[model samples]
Target: MKKVLAILLAACMVVALFACGGKTDPTPSADPTPTAATTPGGEEKPTPGPTTDGVPLGKILEGDHAGREKYKIVYMCNTLAWAWNAAIADTLGKLGEPLNYEFTAWAANNDFDAYLNNIPAFANQGYQGFVLGIDDTLAQASMEACLEAGVSFVAESTTIMDKDGLCIWSSVQQAQVKNGGIAVQWLYDHWKDYWTDATLDGQKVGLIGLNYSAVSGINERKPGVEQKFAELFPDGKFFDGDLAALGTTGFSAEGGNQLSTQIYSQNPDIEKWFVVAYVDDWAIGATRAAEQQNITDKTLVVSIQADAFLAEMSNNYTGNVYVAACAVSSTEFAIDMANYLVATISGVATPETIWPEWNDAGGSYPRIQVEGTMITRDTYKDYLAKQAAMLP
Candidate 1:
């Protein structure tokens, strides 16, 4: 009825607060100062968890708070099965002990009732902050509940907006349009080399965009790639496997492989393919499909999040079809959430205060988008070295 999965996803974040730990042993980066504080109810910091050197605040903030005086708070989010979510969850697991944070991550498994129930459960259980990635339409009641409970809140992936088309809370993640455009820029510069024997009239070159339209953060990625492809190759043929439209989760690499296989199979003439995927898993799927069809040399893929790409040690560009990926740096994003929440609770920053960038840009609610960066096989080693230094 559906597709398949290849994730070695840990059960860590599939449940509520304080349930599990990360697979990593990340230590905190050296700090100019050591942190020592308690949560507002005089609760202690340093919960039982992994150690982490924090990403460092620009300066020791002046106050402990959002409007109340507090040092730290419990942070939670939905879903750990997804790589991005898992990375965030792992960071939470590591940072809590050193930074005085109480945090957890897990999925609701698409059960809306179970998802909505956590919002109230979090408040009832004394949690003071959350980074939620929820359905926009279903967010109002939960968002209202968080506001009423005085929970410092941040939206993950997409900003929670009010009925009047205004944002209600700060959001974390990349600018969707720009994130997609990264794929286009890479494809525009590189597609030609891959299209050597292909011809537009012969229907040999196909541009495929893998769509995950269910979430605004991901859905917004498709248009940027599509619009750019049209302008650059006016006669090009583009195809899609809109997973949301097809009523699929759009996550599994195997699903990606199956969907892309169908696309390539139907258009047998499409020998040179360029796949722009919203995430790494789908991109890997498309790459696998190209390999299976023996067109690896003529296919190229670019997507957001280098999670899977980093796991592969081969020369991903020359040795494989998947070429590039972008990262929101799950580590950095997780740290920013902690910093912003503490800054708000300690009275140094307002709910509208733009973190990391420190400016609201005149928006009612802050939409803090981590700039995305392209990573290729050529540079993954450096990225890995940096990760090693940070974690060790």
Candidate 2:
């Protein structure tokens, strides 16, 4: 009996061992909860924070590491109140913060003396850079002052003369002469039928110029037109006889109106009147003159610089008034100049140059040439759409 009892005790021990082993190795629970690994103190290890392309947000948010310094530049225009002023200002502001620079603008409002006088004021006020859209007659003096003051200056819209290394101007637009050629071409192409008769070949075309007293660009456009007309129609004579009527007035709508009336009265039978002025203010005055004289159908009106009146003329002035404008991307050019000036001040070796070559395209200068868009009654809508897309 003792031996049998001992056997039973051994069997019971084996069964208890099997039961403990089964409990230890049982299948994982159907709804198991995952427990993260922890440190010796029972604190969970931190998961790596989210990253941008493997770079941590904290690191990416840091400021520019290139160590570029900020610069201050001053831009001077013929006038700040002009429509193009807003464009230049907008571009400069857009380029300022990104490139770490500032652009301050000063305007002379088409006053040659005022422009010349403002140079010292800007220099005294800590302006180190300048972009000049100055009167041509005064450009020599203005540029000399800029160089004397040690201010790095760039010229836009207007050309400046220098003796090789002494003067530098980065022209943003094609020469005013080229723009004048464009106007002349448009007139020849569209109005050739009007002057088709034998007597009209040598007929005179009058020019009404604004601020010819000081502004060279204004004067330059007149000659450009004459030269281009001579090239296209060698027999056509400009500013002679009935066509020789040329007048100058202030740069204002009222001035344009007053001048237009005088021109109409002086030469009523003048076949064509080319107003070398901005499309809106001057064109408006010309339209008013045509309306008052009841000669809207007989005269051909052309203008430069597209504006609200030009847009309206594109749609309405089909037979009466013809408009041609030299369209410029002033905003984009301003932005580019701002960037270049900042880069230059920051020690970038790149030099800025004019858009169109002063001579033939042999030399090296960074120039961006923008062409004017021609608008007629048929294409007014298309022009409007394009103009709208450029906004903002």
Candidate 3:
């Protein structure tokens, strides 16, 4: 079953590459200069589709109406404060232009009740399908509401357990695990340069974790990072930052800043940090704390969600200390998701057969895990260059 899915996924990726006009060169670097020249502000564009002359790119209909108007779908975001989330919402709305669907997004501003309330409200408006940024505690309610309304659903970033949802999509957990390994390897390679007497045995590393109680995908990533660290340096010390405590204030940049500050004060000797957060604001907050505490030169942060930190990562000052990130393109994911929902609604595929992860019998929810890109200064610059070429 897994093998069949792998072939299908590979075929999809090949199709994606060709759709984007093909891949770039074989190598990318840590330097900020791009191998290919870039057009200004064109970095990381979304996947291409039939947007020519405003003709909506609806798929060839076969089952019911062969040549009809596009369907309507709506998306609800958990919060738009995080740039990545906003980008995801925006991309979905725009991609509908070519895909023969009406796409709209609503922001819940991280309010749990607001997030829960919006689901039924959106469904009541006659949307055929919904793409949701999930809050696990409220997911069952949301799913029930959609079911009652007779709307098909697709969830992102988190999964709905034991529910009959169409699909659940998120960034690959294995890439996040590999992100931890990359963090450790980077520290090992450059330890001597940072500290003359630095040794792997007693070196302290701090982890800033995302709250993962009901969010299993993120919960799974934490152990992978920890296990890899243990494998690489058995005697190294690790400190964990309290994510629940951080949420007391809020979940925005301010909350992140306060949490990082408190963590830094408690673990003053820790020089390296690994953030198991998909939101870039948390990592940026940690860097901001490093600056305020006058430890910028002595600290390094390895994290996920690179788009929000692209500008900082490209600059020499912040770039040096920021180290690396695991990047999942919001635009690409949004495009993939929009198409998946359209395909399911159009009767081209079912939820289980849409992607491979959905076939796992033991898991309560069917899902698709998409891999991410590694972002260093050079690779980020290279990404920008490639995106520029794809324009026009």
Candidate 4:
């Protein structure tokens, strides 16, 4: 009986040893793949979502209007006989169908009274939208008439006061101001060290003001440069004492040539000449005048608005022509306004004002401020390529 009890105790001891060994090293099972072990500080990272730089998705989605009915819009400009008119016509043509709209242009040929008289005529013709490239003097009354007729009105490159709910103003990216400031800043950055210190101190920068009678954009741009120069050089002489006025009408080149000739004749010592004109056509005229006197090299010509011809000249002359910046045509803004009108007619929330106050710093607007490209001879090829890419 004692031997039988010993046998049972020995079996119990053997079972206990097997159990302890299994906990330390278990036997391999049918599925022998090892499981992944978690580390002491293991963590699973989450995936990232999408993002835009700063523009809200709501603003991006705001102006979309699909399957809307067609609408008729009349675009009025102070002078319908120029490149600007062509730009407006082309822009409107592109906006057709997609926005369901047709634009008719009424050019007043720079006559303020004629522009005012044509408003009611256009409204009577069943037009719903009116775009005005107005003379500053006629803005208030024309805007008032538009409000009275319940026709939505938009002004390009200018604004009229006292019409809060009636008018939308498209602000071109202050191209005139930007171009002027850039030209001056370029001179300061690149050529200031070259000028004799004494000459640089008293250097006279002459501004050739164009369309003094009718052009508002040119007028605003001149003051921007003047103010910038004042800020940069507190005691610098801004040769405002010399003013050469040119008309944008027929013979703009001739007018530019005549004015430039007069300026050179009166103040030959002027070192830098900043032209406040719409295009290189005026600069071409000034170049002709400089050629007549064999003085092209003496003057540093800085002008706004660059087309194919101006771009080529900038390449050839290098430092003589100095800087060329673009004041992109108002045509794109006209197209945007047409699209906005279609959206508004379709009951979408549209801006009451064309040039909203927020767009002063290149912000949002029905009439967004389109910026100009600044080009020098070194950068002309790249500028041309970019403009070419935008064609289609």
Candidate 5:
């Protein structure tokens, strides 16, 4: 009861699971990159192409909603090719059955233009509400369109300009950021066990980010990693510290593999790697690249957005290279969003009442933050059990 927003968003809450600590650099050490990694058996590695086909979007959701309350809702997914987006879209598609809302989902295919185009199309079709997994580039347009159409919309995991009618819901940005730092700490905690070295002064690290284009939610995570690195090893360095080239086409396994290969070729001495991708594909790609370079044992790989499938893969992977991952369950997040949407449509909640940031008197937007689960090989089973227990 601390605030109206907290009371309304009881289901869409954020829970911080860990804190970060740091140690100063005791000695001025040399650069971390000691040597470059070579391809297996000293063979030349193939040059990676621009596109590595990522996971296909799962089957589309279709069924008869013959007798439902006929609340046509369109859920605009960020991209269907990514597993997380697909999971969310698919979950919302099915929610219409029990939730009494007609659902239709469309994939933006990671295209900003396409994302923009989808908005008016849905509005023209007379869709009542939109559940948008927003991209930073085009949120204002979408919000304006929804406003003009007199349609209610909520943003999932991303925000648009603060407007009166819109509500933004996401897992806590710090949750993702903290996981970034946690990945770094994972290596530090286990560094002695792997290297038998007393200190971790000159270890080079590699990073693969979704993109460097100032996407609000994703960009903050890189600093979280950097902050942790600086804390643990004062002046600890990344491969090149070049922010511009650190991004990828999309968070795909192909992009991950290609980027990892590129990083391996460019800075083979990187002893550890941190990846904050759009999805789990980057983790899979990096691990594959590490194995091919025959440096799986030497490198520590940590990532975020490990979906259920990839978490299972973490259990099966041979070594600890796929170190730690945070699972932001897209399906669960979608469910919570659906509940909010249902409440809003039923006249039970409004932006000003539920979102702390929304000002009833000030005419502002609403924002909700949710929590995610972290998974390691050891903790995966527990996560699975908790998820299963939720099933009817």
Candidate 6:
């Protein structure tokens, strides 16, 4: 809440998760090369031409209450081939009905330069609005392109930050600080069932926060949990794992597995592992590695956005290894973002009136953040019931 926008998303790298944190550097430290990631589960995306190929540009999903002017918008993300982005696309597509707009789901494939390039590509092509799942390194340039074209933008998964690394503008992302802090507290409270404070303070357990240092959006997921952990266990030996080194698409389970495996192999003195992650794919991957190593007994992982894992959470990734997650409805997220983008573009809402209240916390931006629910194996049904209520 100090400086990053947190609201309205959870998926891609399973993108669309809550993004909170500052922009320390314009460029992320990871390699920008596009790699394959089969998560959130659907078909795979081709090297995103950022074109109309897999991207369903100008496609209109059937809807109701017509007679309104239709505008073109784009949901530019890492890839559409994966399930994470696909569900969001479907939800965005449906907004055409009562909201009255068409869209192109541009799969950018984690290419930073491509974001710079394609903003103009589609802007010149008459795309009037954009919902981006990207970092703020290029926020200035991206904003410039939109300004030139008279295009409106609403950020998802990633908040657009200012030159000062403070959040700026409107975004729909997760509650990074709130969720991170709460998850740590939950993990700590649950851990009390088996371990004592002296044992935790004794340095027998190690903490790992997995992230791609380059993707500032996903990195937001860590600070909340890390801050809470530091307060609880001052001597906690926390390891920050850079999944960028694994180099699979930004947030893949495979990348997480490789990173956690390395962490486990390298840290021999640690008796237990507690991992904090954002996307379900990465958490699932980390859980896979922990289970394979037979360390779930001592290791517990919690993550945000259960969309990717919900399909199979009951059958797999059960128990305390992957433990709990914060679930947000993709349908609900897209609806909120689509409405905000169109409303802002159409002048139906402004910076002053977009959010219901100004005192609401979401960094320093005009954010329409969606709250998430924490669910465990014991409360999966409750989440499902809650998820069902939001169905279109």
lDDT of 4: 0.51
- Candidate 6, residue 49: Cα displacement in angstroms equals 40
Best model per TM-score:
1
Candidate 2 per-residue lDDT over residues 17-104, each given as its tens digit = 4443221111100001111112212233342232222211111112351466556677777665445554565556554565565666
**Whole-model lDDT values for every prediction:** 0.62, 0.51, 0.55, 0.51, 0.53, 0.63
Superposed by TM-score, candidate 4 places the C-alpha of residue 310 at a distance from the truth, in angstroms, of 4.5
Query: Where does model 1 exceed 4 Å of error?
Result: 1-77, 192-204, 314-318, 354-362, 387-392
Write the residue-wise lDDT of candidate 6 on 1-392 in tens digits. 63333332223323442221101111101111111111111123342222211211112222332656788888877666545567677667666555677766776666778877888898888888888766666666676666676778877766666676555666666555565666777778787653444356447677888777766666776887788888887777888887877666545888888888889878879887888776677787888888888887778887766755565565664466877776655655665577667666666665445643321344444544444566777777766764444434
lDDT of 2: 0.51
- Of the candidates numbered 2 and 3, which has the greater TM-score value? 3
Q: By TM-score, highest first, what's the ranking?
A: 1, 6, 3, 5, 4, 2
TM-score of each: 0.77, 0.63, 0.70, 0.67, 0.70, 0.74
**Candidate 3 Cα lDDT to native:** 0.55
Q: Candidate 5: where is the Cα deviation over 4 Å?
A: 1-68, 110-114, 124-126, 162-175, 190-199, 203-216, 240-251, 269-278, 308-315, 355-364
RMSD of candidate 2 to the true fold?
Answer: 29.9
**What does each candidate score in C-alpha RMSD?**
10.0, 29.9, 14.4, 30.6, 18.2, 14.2
Best first by lDDT, ranked: 6, 1, 3, 5, 2, 4
lDDT of 1: 0.62
TM-score of 4: 0.67
List the pairs of residues colliding in candidate 3.
57-98
> What residue pairs clash in candidate 4, if any at all?
168-353, 168-354, 169-354, 169-355
Candidate 2 colliding pairs? 171-354, 204-243, 239-244, 240-244, 327-372, 355-367
- Could you tell which candidate, 4 or 5, scores higher by lDDT? 5
- The candidate that achieves the highest lDDT relative to the unseen native structure: 6
- Candidate 3 residue-wise lDDT, 1-392, digit = tens: 99999999999997764333211121211211111111111132232233321111112212333265677787776655456666666666665655677766666655778777767777677678788776666667777776777776777665665556433332111234444444455555654664566454345665555433334544545665566667766655554544555444535556666777777777777765544443455667777777787876666665666664675664554444566666655554565567667766776655555543233344333344434555666567776665333211
